[model samples]
Target: MKSLNKVLLGSATLLAAITLAACGKSSSDSTTSDSKTVSGTVKLWVDTTKVPYYKTIVKDFNKEYPDVKVTVTQSPNGSANAKTDVGKDPSKAADVFEVANDQLGSMANQGYINPLSPAATKAVKKNNVAVASEAVTWDGKMYGYPTSQQAQTLYYNKAKLSADDVKTWAGLTAKGVVATDFTNAYNFYPVFLSAGTYLYGKNGETLKGTDANTAAGVAAMTWFAQQKSNKGVMQTSNALNQLKSGNAAATLDGPWDSANIKKILGDDFAVAPYPTINVGGKDVQMQAFLGVGCFAVNSNTATKNQKAAATLAQYVTNKKSQLVVYKHSGAIPVDKAAQASSTVASDPVAKAVITMSQEGYSTIMPKMTQMATFWNLSAPLINGAYTGSIPAAQYQAKLDTFVSAISKAN
Candidate 1:
């Protein structure tokens, strides 16, 4: 349950290509005089899975600000581009929108959103991870308020492996555990991070490649391939079946899987960070794949509407609302104060994600424009090397081809 049930390279494709599919989740608020009635048609767009929980938070907010009557609406799942399309016109615009980190570049480039003022930016800066803020910033201006954040970590069944036993990928395999639908490209993320290899060069946002294709990267990829591909020790045909049927016991993933995992395993579930990798003769830390979801105000909203939207966004992202949102959605709260709450801080999985988010060098998932071009071939090529379909020496050439394909497409 802690592992994702499905792997959508397609979503990753959208992310890398700089095109977003839109979902129609909507929220509303109204203005008033007596008691400061907060009534207006506030528009919102979010995934369906989050709509119900979002409604609860909106309801609670309405209770506190009764004068502001609010409405909530659900969006079709996996349609981020459609949401962006509506944002083009005020008639169909959402007062506030939820854009995934991967799609931020496109959304920002289209000028559909407004940047946060210095005051609001400072507020978010005080509590949020610097990377989270940076992910939503473009051209040195902040445009979004992060609502939730996450990074990769290990989740295991306590009944199956001791935390100490589940610390490393090798250990997890020893316990007869494996990843759920993880491609070699995805699985190697931890090792690359631990090795301090990033997909793009951090200097001036240049993406010319890095040591991620190095011997260390290949070694790590080969190790995982041996477990899942060669040794037959790890389950290859969907790791979730292994978890659901008790065939597998440990896996790596993020908070997105928490709620379902809780339902499947109950209290037997345990969480830990990725096992350390060797770097420079030292035990390096786990590399986490970090991403975030944020709220942005429309650039076209009137100054009055913009101010009100900003206020509403801040209120919803505040500690109490974050608690409600995280509890219901299984999302990592963006507020530092919320991270300290017993409910969040006590969870080992949440803790591991936070630990990684804090120390981990967060990177942008490729903007949508490059996804399919890079990943469609990248995953296959990387998997081929690990599975012995391609020679190890050819790794750099294969990677170069994929990168060239995607870069040219972009």
Candidate 2:
């Protein structure tokens, strides 16, 4: 982790420099590093388990800007439910809340959060991983400060399978069993990406431009069907337990589970990027949806508190706070400096996730308003194909229907 004072200094400097109006301007009043002028009451929503650590971070935040009083509370639901919870009534939601990257587009479109000012955006871009900056941007504006990354990578037992063996799907399945769930779209939808199809188009912003209804899409579905017959591939909802019981040699998982995985595999634990799979007769790299967790300032926050809320959002997502989140929650840090620190660089799980976050390894999850519909429809579509219920002949038709349904305006 970087020095706390340095990170705080950066946060203080950015806070001092920002003069732009936030999403809602109730008053002509402005906030700066001047503790008295910036004083306001703001609420922060975080995961229940994170309340304690975050409160500690807020304590340090107050030392720099004492007049800004922060109330840290557990969100009504976890971060995964951020969109729905905030949507229920944005004005009632916390002033600053935690959210995942995928929900940003709809939230931004619906006017639930404020976009970062250009100065804040420039600061964020200069400090975090390149992918982190990319993940928080929806359309042309950045709506949140990225704090951590969430990408599923290959977690294996080195004693059972060599690193090279895990490099290709065929190589992995032939040597040992892999426990995974085809019902999970997050785990397998990127198979379409590997097959050379785009989700919401190349830049991932075009609402009607998702291109997954072609021969490439069918090839990806067919590859799923083949996995059903592969003895080395085990369909399981609980992969960690399978790995612990020796029923599977590896599984696809995100950093959230790295701590538990380490305890289960102990001396044999190893991690790697996704393997190349045989799709359309050629080996192509398997990709995962790259998710970045972030902190967003609500557009509905009281106008007088807008600056404080924005500052709090930036403060808690800085490198020091990010490291705290990583230490206490196992979220892979998105800060470039934090990542290069020995604590993170030395961790195999973090290294693999960071590598997987790069281009060609994963795709930034599209943040379209229609993405909610995508999640609801895609898992069943993917599962039906994987389980042979959708059938090989209907692969194209099913994909066509799936794409059309999610492409419609909300």
Candidate 3:
């Protein structure tokens, strides 16, 4: 992995340098190395899970722009006061912070972020699409640049079903081979969504909890309960391992798993968009939670520093960097032009992921008070239902009511 990271960096040295140097600083400072050099450091906070990828990006960035140093800090996502620590002290805050997009709305509302000015708007708009930019905008204001895209997909072992064989859920089930990481929040949502059910509804512009207790919704939930037998027959494990090995015939997953599938299953893998269902005579699409790892400017910073932070954010998410992100990291490039490359379209793994991303829509991950606690409760509850210990009708009634009450208060 280290050698692969270095190879990617060396291949793109000049491009990385040009990108980092162009992001202006919010304040002017003297540089002893060269008078014309930009002089300032950008403190970046990233989730520790992503440190491996970011380290390479940072190393290559530093080589090109020695005048602009980036201090990369890793903080665990589980830290109790992580957000509070950054929110309270500008001195301790990262000039660029990457958090889940569901948290972006509340944080931006709290005055924690600086709004993207016209320059950023132009830069991102030219490179990305409205769907890719979804998470970065709140209340009509753009605040972040999208880092990657995800969509639910039905990944199958080509040995089991060709592209022509398993096109629908019935075909999938008839094969008596289907599995999922029934434990994960994002991956399981597709099973429910494929049955024409949803956790929330948009009443005009406002999002409201609805349809969770409806007949169709309960039936969808029941289908998942029935899948436990299928799970056992298919030899289920965690989605990563299950899909990586060719033991499981099919599993629902996101674009992030594309490379791992290739690494594990080799040439025997294929992916297709999850099937749809008719709701009220209209075909409603499944909505997964979309998020962005954005470069955020600290609002508390001096104006000059803030401006520079914005520039860095823009450059890092530009077409060139996005290409690197797509090629090496296996992340879907936010830049639409990057998708047009023959390399992206011709590569089997990338082709499957790009197709899924293009057709997908996303819901915001829940971030209100007690939301994490609710997840704690929901995971086991949902798992128990999937494993058939809990009856679907009874479980749905209890779970829906509990979640509704929690949503109201939180």
Candidate 4:
């Protein structure tokens, strides 16, 4: 791993040399001239698991820009901690780093990452899915190139319930065998979303909590309350163990669980979009919070290296590189062409997620800092609702309080 001192020293030395050369030149003139001859050692941070795929991408990138070299480093914690790591020192941060979409807003707010250059922005728009593209945009500016799309899907035991039987919450509950961590806001959020509840207003750009007091919100809460009595719904610590032991017919989860679930269920393991839930006697398809993986540039990198950093970011997210990532890791490709390819279309999990993305049934996880408060306030409410501590009659009031608290905090 490169130390912060080395990173800062390299950037300072490079910037000082560039400064002397452009002493009499305008910033715009310097930028234009540098773009044509952009060449430098771009430090790239990739998830430890994806380092091999990125190494392959670097090899391919070298074919187009032989003068530029990319140094790939493995980030043990993956993109989840990228914001904090980069924030510690933007000048010392990796020139290019992979991050989850939810980090974009915080990173941009803190000046840790740069806005995408015009060419980079255009490439992202043209190649990636709309939701993936939208997830990387913060305050109307594109910050990163999307690499993959991630969202939870229904993983079930085919022998216990047919595909049709798992389409609705009522139908699945009737089978008397379902398991999920009800306390987890992420796992249970679909119940509220299916009933048209939202965590924020203005398409998640603002932090006005859901109208939990509304008829829709109350109805959703009522249904969640009923789950407590559903003997079929296990409340164990290891829900996956319940499925593995044949005690549960299905579980709500994501692609990351696919490998282990498949190992346990073999040919019986299957995945589909979340089932519809009954809200006020009406069936609505559950909506999942979508997460996107992306690559962003360090805003404080040497000016001469910014264009090269953008080039490298764009290169790794292109269709070809996306296909490589899909092959190595089971991550769903955000590139339209790569997603449409037979390789992706043939995979059941990838196909189901792609369908959900195309149909616009998923919500992008909000990247705003206010989300921290939303999660904190909503978790207790969800737990209370599930355990019957928060009665159905008080669901509205509780939701209202939650919204007010978060609004005030934000």
Candidate 5:
């Protein structure tokens, strides 16, 4: 994956150079004219589920750039596949598209997406949540306009767990109704992350092995094993459904579960940042992996269409459009103004997710391709620890093996 990424980067750099030279004009000059005189059809790709929100955004965008016709299409492959889909055929790529922040590195490295214009960068910094802004930035360059923030939060039944009761793992364990997917590394990662275990170093520029055998990692795994024995942790295929059926008082999950869970729990539904966990008699706050949803311009877009595409991207991510998205999809908006609005302010789930993204000790999901190997290597370790196949006493040895595997993979 690392070698392939380097080849993609080299090819993309050359393509960008050729495209720039062929235009025979500075980006600044093209941007100025493209912003006003440029009038052409611009294509946008969005998740099938989000097509309505994008349609609404396009309607509003057209009012401003009436001459720039915008067509919205659903990306059958989903946002994560945007880079490969675009790279396969630049002419077929949408002028602007929505993608998860982790895809930014691949898209930018492959030149599937364009770097943000100065104005777009400024808007991203000024209006977005800090982590959301940071997620879209690749190698010190901003690539996308952030739209929403994603992270796991503690969703609880207010009837069973009080606001304070959900604040700590020990407290929840005593209540004995909290459940989370113990087998999946993504869902259980907060344990190691909050304990200071990391999957990579140098801001994802390097794939350093984790410290899962350290005191922190062992403590986290021990706590998790205890939960499994007590039935407070679940490895079921239907964790969310179980939570919705009132099988558990609380569950750790991302905002994607909000709509369905909210329908089931209704007024009893509530969310809070991941609680502090007791590890070796010390309290450590659990941290979540953070992600951002954003829109990026296609590098293949015609010079006359770049500014229009950027304009539409900005318009959709702005406070007004984000509010519309929140209303339609229940996604936590990244725009500060939108987040501060009464609708999101009053939504406990939205507030909790935003807080986790900002105040919690959350780690941004690394964009490096090496992350693929980390996920594959970490899953068995997490599962083995949870099922007691890898006992606490043996955690150090297993961790050493895991690290060795990662090094070999690298």
Candidate 6:
């Protein structure tokens, strides 16, 4: 089993963020962490499906800081749409809310969220996965309290294909059908990374550092076009349905849907890190975009309640609460201790997620504000290539256009 807890902290970027956060601690915090006498009425927004379990977690939090009253409610839109929901009106948003790491940069810049207090940031860095800390950091400040790490892995039916067959794309397809969606940029855009190119550069902060317009980018686009004719690959909007019906022997998915798949595949259920695929005549590990889910404190919270709000954010993401979340929702915990617990370490699903979250198998989704623009452009480009609507001759031109648009001032 691949363990998420044992990550090397060697990145200069992550170090710089940690240093700047520590230095910022000398100044007065935007929010205080005085839990003892802190008092406030703070609201927390979580995904609708998560409200119940989170409410139970809130019970645990209130025991520590009874003076703070917290109301756990469902977000009007889910955490996936947090940026949009919060953007509609920041003042009206929850005092503490859930958000994906990719949105942290834009939210921090737009003043929708406050940087985590130094004490909170320090605890986060010390307690979570190295990449989890890095995920919430933007402009050298920690913007959120990370809760879970995510990456898609290959889920297969062991009855139809052996474990060895699923390790290589060619072998899986040759033996049984694999269903997936090319329309999801989330599903296929990592082909560019697998093909050997950077999405916002090595550190993912440089705008022009994106080189999807280069030869490597063209190669990735070409691979997408080639898949349209691959007999073994089935393109479907609902890959899960295909797998459920036995039309597809395998599908790529994350931990969120594990329960449903387990129910469907029963004893035959199996999962593993993505298989190797031949791109540009060389077999390379297929990659997925890794993501971290975090809870951010609103910058718009009442000044009197700042400490209370910060306390709530910190409480729900602590190691014990993270394990609770993992048990109830299958959100793979980013907490180092939680990941190392027997419950997580021995779980097959967690092992696959931890393996895929590593250097060669995945890329952490970049936390650039311009990511909004990249998402708008990436999906259509990938879909067009897969459907051959963009044509083979225009692969370079299409990629060039995409890189140029996203590289502009953010």
RMSD of each: 7.3, 4.9, 6.9, 6.6, 6.0, 5.6
Q: lDDT tens string, model 4, 150-259?
A: 77788888887888888887788787488887677766665677777776664667765556557877787887787899876777667789988889988876766667
List model 1 lDDT by residue over 1-410, tens digit each. Answer: 11111111000000000111122112222111222333444566656667787778777666655544455555433324433554457445666666665555555556565556555666678876566677666656666677777676777788988877766555666665655544545554445556555564552134464445665655544543454352424636465557778877766667777666766677787777777654534466657556666766655554444444545565666777778877776677767778788998887767877776765533455444454354566567645755667676666666556546654525
**Candidate 2 deviant stretches above 4 angstroms:** 1-14, 17-37
Residue 182 lDDT, candidate 2, scale 0-100: 90
**Global lDDT scores for all candidate models:** 0.57, 0.83, 0.53, 0.71, 0.70, 0.81
| Candidate 2 residue pairs in clash (backbone atoms < 3 Å) | none
Clashes of 6: 0
Worst 10 residues of 3 by lDDT: 4-13
Residue-by-residue lDDT tens digits, candidate 6, 1-410:
01111110000111111111111224344534332666788899998888999999889777766778999999887787788898898788898898888888888778777676566677778888788888888888888888888898999999999999999999999999999988888888999999999988887878888998888888888888888888879999888899999999999888888888999899999999999988888899999888888888777777677767777777788888888888988889888878899999999999999999888999988988787788789989999999989997898888888999999986
Q: Residue 173: error of model 3 in Å? A: 3.2
Which runs of model 1 end up more than 4 angstroms from their true locations? 1-40, 63-69, 78-91, 184-187, 209-225, 228-237, 278-284, 302-304, 361-372
lDDT of 5 by residue, 1-410 (tens): 21112111000000010111112112331132232443566899988878877788788767766888999998757776677677788777888887777778866666576566554566578776677778888888877778887777888888988888888887876774876666667777667877777666536445564556678777777876776677555567676777777788888777877788888788888888888887667788888777777877776678766666666676777788877877887778887778778988998888788778864457777777656666777777777877888887888887777766665433
User: Number of clashing residue pairs in every model?
Assistant: 42, 0, 7, 0, 0, 0
- In order of appearance, the predictions have TM-scores of 0.79, 0.93, 0.76, 0.88, 0.87, 0.91
Candidate 6 weakest lDDT stretch, 10 residues: 4-13
**Which rank order by lDDT, best down to worst?**
2, 6, 4, 5, 1, 3
Model 3 lDDT, residue 325, Cα: 64
Model 2 Cα lDDT, one tens digit per residue, 156-232: 99999999999999999999999999988888999999999999998889878888899899999999999999999
> Which candidate, 1 or 6, has the higher TM-score?
6
Q: State the local distance difference test value for candidate 4.
A: 0.71
Quick one: best lDDT, which candidate?
A: 2
The candidate that achieves the highest TM-score relative to the unseen native structure: 2
In model 6, which runs have C-alpha deviations exceeding 4 angstroms? Answer: 1-28, 31-35
lDDT of 2: 0.83
